[model samples]
Target chain A: MKVAQILKTCTRRAVLAAGLALGSAVSATAEEVFVYNWADYFPPELFDKFTEETGIRVRLDVYQSNEELAAKLQAGGTGYDVIVPGDYMVQQLAQQGLLQEIDFKTLENFPNVEGPLKFPVFDPERLYSAPYLHGSTGISYDSEKVGELEESWSVFFDPDPALSGQIVALDDELEMYKAAAMYLDIDYCTEDPAEATRILELLEAQKPHLLMYSSGGSIERMAAREVPMHHHWANGPFRVREEAPSWRMLFPKEGVNLWADNFAIPVGAQNVEGAKAFINFMLEPENIAAATNFNGYANSIPASRDFIDESVVNDRGIYPGEDIETRYVGNRLCSVEARDLRNRVWTRVRS
Target chain B: MSNRSAHSYLAIGLPLLALAFLFFGPLLAILAASFTERAPNGGIDWSGPVFDAYTALFYTPDLFGELEPNRAFLSAFSRSLYLATCTTLICLVAAIPMAIYISRRSERTKTLLLLLITIPFWANLLARNYAWILILRANGLLDSALQSIWPGFEGTGLLYSETAILIGLVYSFLPFMVLPIFASAERFDWDLVSASRDLGASVSRTYGKVVLPLLTPGILAGSILVFIPSMGNFITPQLLGGGQDFMLGNLIALQFGASRNWAHGAAIAVGLMIGISLVLLCLRRLGPKGPHLSGGA
Candidate 1:
């Protein structure tokens, strides 16, 4: 009867308000989960399916960047039941006591997780987070324009004369600096000013060739033939493939930064039970496969592979070979000193 | 008298409370945060007051605590000032004739022309900026249109340059300049112009000496409105200028967003506010008094 009452209030409120912008009054007695994740990450119909099956009303909000999500949680009282933070952020949030232990190992679908993803460097014991989607950052270029270039960072760092004013890179400091560091064979988390200066020099040289440094509109911009080469992520090429079949995404010889987004409940979540149920539901092979098919990113659940779209599963951009797998290295949680150096380098590069 | 005083207090008290809560509250918080240090985890460390953030604007501390002269933020600030100044000057030159022309029209025509000026505002600013990209990019609409006229012509590719940013800024803020000058020009007396001409004054002298002095107040107000916002604008530069160079607003955003140095961001904001306030004070002192416009009435 009590469970029924909770479901009744949740569904009734969901019908009235579409389960959005109302998180406070019914929070004490409702079976509702608020999901905050990256933009364009989840299929819209998946939420309805989730609510239908579990009777736990799902409300979704999206954020543009990991820092924004961290900032919101840091400000406190977000009323968010579940948050999707990237790899290093999970460790940071867990260390700051902003995340509660989820004991994901006890979950029924724990066995579905990929072996390597089970003990991620960020959350070794699966204590505070569950792996959601995983991907890597690399170059996505129009082969027709670039004309058979080597699969190396040099294509971006030392752009050809023909490619001048037709290349672009991400505006993010971390991703940009990481790519530079990899190209220069320097440490990504180096606090050394000399090393940072070297990275800055490389970026400054590339700056003139770049049309812009933007993180948004990669797919649309590429589709419109705005740039021949765009520093992009794995999922970007898949989305761009339909529009620009001549374009190709590649991992450079140096390396690429591998990232994993994980689902973790914040400390003061209103409906932890509902949040847990949602996470468990998402862990299902069929459900997460739908997310992969929709967003064109790989999920951590290995069993979901069979359910993935053939175009995505077979795409080299999404699933690179074993030899190139070594190039997908995990990102480091840079020290405060190192982060300061990186920020200064970015400012100088932009200036 | 006591009842009147009580009513006056009630009238002023509510607005004052609202101002304090809405304006001063956040302003004071930012001011306080500017003087604080950054925690290890990228948020403000409110343990104590420090000038590290302000110092960081000019000098970056090395591993040994020695300060290195940093020109990054200084360059961004100067670039923002340069762009804003250019936008204001261009807008002033372009808006004066347009405003004067609008003010001289029939009453209904004047209203219609002003309506036409504001029709662009009905569309979203972001969408308009994106449209500018479509027009300004290489081999884009402009190039295609030009190519139709001259088959061999190639586009210079204006899209991601400072020129494009200037074009976007001037286009966005021109109405701010026009409306204020129009308001002043609408009140101009035609008799002064005829009197100057009757006295055998040259056309240039009559216009320069009579028309310019009366429009100072409107020009000052318009300049302030256009210059201040354009100086701190990040979107136009990010979209049109390709974000290769960081403007003042973009630099502040970098400090807050990726840099995760809220104190530094707050410090830059406070510094920008102070700089703009000083500029406004100078402009006020330089502007003609209300009596300068009395001849118009």
Candidate 2:
């Protein structure tokens, strides 16, 4: 009830209590690591294995969106030992002073993490976060219904009235606004009022022909052929393709929005030792491979290729290519005022 | 005497205090936040009360030009009112006759009918909505059934349309409309109907004059129950309507969550409360006789 409001004012007390809680929790024979991550993010077996080996119970909580996670952490009293934030969000949290510095000396397996994740821009020296999964957001469509569909954001932006009620764009403001900006050849994170108007018009044009704006549920409808084409997130499109093989994911010529989710410890984490142990265990090649195979996202562990699911390993949609570096778009974490302006326009898109 | 007074105080005062702290307390906070200034980091500024957020609802701030009223918020408000009225009307019409029929049933049959009406409530709301999606979508239940009959027939896509949103709304609110109306109908004076018929009133006239008027209080209450919630319900439109739908509830949620504007979200919520209150005030005129014998035998 009133707990949400109380939590906001309880920040200092929670921080002090959690700071004291850390040492006591570690000195205990068995401790509970308060792990918080995305809903359906990791394999259940991973937690069970960690608990069995280390005698530390994994008390996990799931968040559906980064915004929701940010809200809880911002309010404080979350009492989480570990939190997995998306790439941009990790830096966002770090900048907000909400995350603790990662102690790499405690994690021996940190060197095994390679590729773009090694010296990730979000944490250049790997001090704040480590990559959990990397994937690209793009177009996922039914091949049989729309034969020879081009790899373009135009399918979502320049909708055909003939294809009315069969197209969907993601409901995410930050992500889909990027697609709209890319489609119109404009900066996604602009503060210009005229640019906001243009983006609004672009989205409004798609509304008549648009089926729905969704975050995660668009995949279910697309897989069921309820929607012929959807502006989809990377991992969802890959998972949906497995169910409906005729479904294909396309990264446009304008390029794609690649997401890298990372594992980070929040400030005032109560079970730091247990959290570090869990993270180190997760960083192992076999354990990381288990995550990739089960969750259908590419992990950063270099030798994970050997243990990853064969279908996922060979699939073009899952592993686009080695040259994903050229496709990377810098995630510009927009300032609050800029985001407010964009969101004002976004409300117009919904209407 | 003082001890007994203290006992009564504990009995009433404690619960009321708890309720105020738990429910009304938070509601007051939200109402307060609606008038407050937004901090740069998206928290309430708490410096002083400001009408800027309320004005922001209807007008955009402009430095170089005069501010214009926000058309998007107005349009979304109108759309929510329109959809809520539509869902209420459809539910009202379908519920009345069904309630009457159920009320006229034998005791065993009446229980069965009421139970059947409420079976949907047992399932999670989201899962029940998903079941409708599976039933109504292209190549889904209805589509496959049609295909079996016609052989290779492609079905029309319905899941993400306004039509689907209405269907889902009507399905959801049907029982809410029925139970109250059924209770009002079940205890009706059958002798009055006989007297009307015996007095040589025409069959249509007897029902129109006598039966319909008696159900008005229940129908009115049911409509209020259905309409108020439907105005704010974004999930039905989101899931069944394919996220193509934007209701007032989703708009408020967007402000708080993705938009990260607490002051604006609170303003929108206050707007919704005012709208619902206006509608509720209007419904009081329709239900002047008040709900009848709901708690009685």
> TM-score of every model?
0.93, 0.88
Off by over 4 Å in 1: A1-30, B1-14, B62-65, B290-297
Clashing pairs in 1: none
lDDT of 1 by residue, A1-351 (tens): 011223334455465455444433444454778888876677767887986787777777667678888889989998999999998899888988999898977788877887567888889999998988888899998888878888899989998899887898888888899999999999989978889889988998899889889876667788887788899987776787778888888799899888889999999999998888888888999999998898787888878888999999988877876677788878647888888788778888887
DockQ of 1: 0.47
For candidate 1, lDDT tens digit of each residue in B1-297? 799999999999999999999999999999999999877878888998999889898898643347887677889999999999999999999988898899999999999999999999999787788889889987889989999999999786899899999999999999999988888888888789999999999999987999877777677777888999999998888888888877999888887887788999999999999999999777767777555432222
| Model 2 vs. true fold: TM | 0.88
Q: Which ten residues in a row are the worst by lDDT in model 1 chain B?
A: B288-297
DockQ for every model, please: 0.47, 0.39
The structural similarity of chain B in model 2 to the true chain B, as TM-score, is 0.90
